[model samples]
Target: MIRASNVVYSYLKYGRTGEEPVSVRALDHVDLEIERGSFISIIGHNGSGKSTLAKHFNGLLFPKEGTVWIDDLPTDGKGNLAQIRQKVCMVFQNPDNQIIGATVEEDIAFGLENMQVPTEQMQERIDRSLEAVGLTEKRNENPGCLSGGQKQKTAIAGAVAVSPQCLVLDEATAMLDPRARREVIRVARKLNEEEGITVILITHFMDEIIHSHRIFVMDHGVVVQSGTPKEIFADPGLLEQYHLELPPVTKLAFGLRQKGLPLELPVLEPEELLKQLLRIRKGGGAC
Candidate 1:
């Protein structure tokens, strides 16, 4: 489990004012608890602190005030930094920045090597990680030769090769094309569903939140609302306030509702919306 209690972080910047410091509060009195083996999505506008909060989960930045604990280990303590990082792994937006090894298998082995896994076990781990990401055949290939999606998958393989308890993706798909983005998301879903690894997905895309167990919406460094996708999508006004767009299907359902159609509050996917429309057309009971 991960917990943040009244966490606060500030950045000090220097201007041409004779060494004066300016502080910008990236996170402000934020509190949250993420359960084990659950998939959660964090969404917000630009500069809304979603990424800032993500950094805290991996101990990349300690809270200036209050506390952040990962599985009972305080992230602020210098002694626990290594342990905290090992438990929670992070993937960034750019695949280029994350890739280090020349080949896919070598990249997956990089993390395990740092932990000093035996040479005999390294090959097995490398093989397993590559298979997990559906890139076993590309193990011998260079990361530069793969497509954007493949590169991200390789990055994910590297992260999972370490066997972390929790995976924090900070807009991991932002740089990929639509097809590539879908591929990365599918891999993330498989990790959470098949491996039972907790997933913390930080993204601005509304479609990505549909599969999440819970959604947390942030604005101006504060958590404004959080709930299941159904509850969060029910209020179009709230989403507009945060400058967020609804999933395409949800928006279509909302438009139907405004036209005197008896549609449900939240229509997460196109299939769900289609089913609801069919039921309504057949004069079925309450949708």
Candidate 2:
């Protein structure tokens, strides 16, 4: 759904004194592709350029050196901006920054209103999006009154209300609690699996990416690793080299396997590890 080639983006840091402005590269020669209707993740530590790359998916920031294509339309063109944005929508880390309307329903309507959708169709969209995010009952409630997770859902509902083909979540769950994080992730998964929307999750939370179809590991403004979740998580040493780590469950599984226990490799979920242990106890597999 999205493709970037040799993309480079830089931020100009101006000195308060009289020094010359310095250009710091946020994305350097990054290249990758995301398939339609698939869930993928971009992960990295702070200052690793994951957020900068997310912005390129929807043209929030144009690349300084290369091109970004959203569903075959290049992001560099002014005329294609509108169509490109419609094809790809984004939810950022802070829901407060994204939330502008007083009520939940009104917030979802904000994008449709900008698109000049007919009033009748707009109401239908509002209803559908509210239901999609499981917030229909809270439609009349103020977004500020909702929990962190609910606020993020509100943001996702607003994005969905626009009828986007692809959704880019740039650390959308960073500020939420664990339960709220799970809720937001579940909504993103449902949107991808049920609605056939391409979902690209940008996060540092390793556990959140375990279920993703593919993962792109970024560092120093470039994609250093890309593979299926299982493939990427299989080697903890490699991830550590990139300043990343396996999910807590995966690390536990790896630790057990290292201690001469019979267990499956790359056990991503808690239940999967439990199942393996039960099988071993039952003599289904050797220790």
Candidate 3:
């Protein structure tokens, strides 16, 4: 499990003379707990401290005031840094930045080699992770030769090959097209459900978060609210206050309901909205 208590981080500012040199609080008394083998999502607009919080989970930045623990191991860089990193892996928004090997298969095995795994075991891990990410056919291709989605899959395969207990995706799908974004989300879901890996998905895409067990909404530097998608979507007023917007399908359904249609007020999924529209049409609520 990952636990954070009263976590605080500040960034120093530098300017011309007599500026007072203020500090910006990127995370203000942030507190959260994530269980092992659970799937979760964190949503916020740009500059909402989503990335700052994600950095803490992996020990990239230590809290200035509080403690962050990964299953009782503190992220204070005393002696648990390497061990914590081994247990928790991070994938970034850009796939190219994470690539380390000349070939796809070699890239997957890079971490295993760094961990000094035996040659035979490394091959097994590479094969398994490639298949897991649906990149087995691209095993021998050049890393730069694949599409954007494929490159991201290759990056994920590399992380999976290491077999970390948890994977924190920091906007892993932001750079992909619609189809590629869906593809990445499907892989993340498969890893969470089939492999039972703890998945921490940080994204701005509301549709991508519908299947998460819980959603944490962050604004400015604090977590304003957290709940399941249903609970969060039900309060459109609260979301709008944070400069956040719902998925397009939810907006459409809510608009129709306001116009005297029988659509659900917070229809989160397109399928749910479709069902309500069908019911309204059959009941002669629409002209």
Candidate 1 error regions (>4 Å): 17-19, 284-287
List ranges where model 3 is wrong by over 4 Å. 16-21
Q: Which stretches of candidate 2 lie over 4 Å from their true place?
A: 284-287
lDDT of 2 by residue, 1-287 (tens): 68999999999999888999999999989989899999999998899998889888887889899999988899996789889889999999999889988999998998999999999899889999999999999999999989989999999999999999999999999999999999999999999999999999998899999999999999999899999999999899999998888999999999999898888799999999998998898995554
Lowest summed lDDT window (length 10), candidate 1: 278-287
Count of steric clashes across candidates, in order: 0, 0, 0
Q: If candidate 2 were superposed on the true structure by all CA atoms, what would the RMSD be?
A: 1.2
Residue-by-residue lDDT tens digits, candidate 3, 1-287: 99989999998888898787889999999999998998999998888899899899879999999999999899997889888888889999999899978899988888888888899899889998999889999999999888889999999998898898899999999999999999999999999999988999999898999899999999988999999888988878988988888888888888888888876678888888888888888888873
lDDT (Cα, tens digit) per residue for candidate 1, span 30-56: 999999899999999999999999999
Per-candidate TM vs. native? 0.96, 0.97, 0.95
lDDT of 1 at 11: 85
Give the Cα-based TM-score of candidate 2 against the true structure: 0.97
lDDT comparison, 1 vs 2, better candidate: 2
Computed on alpha carbons, the lDDT of every model, listed in order, comes to: 0.90, 0.92, 0.90
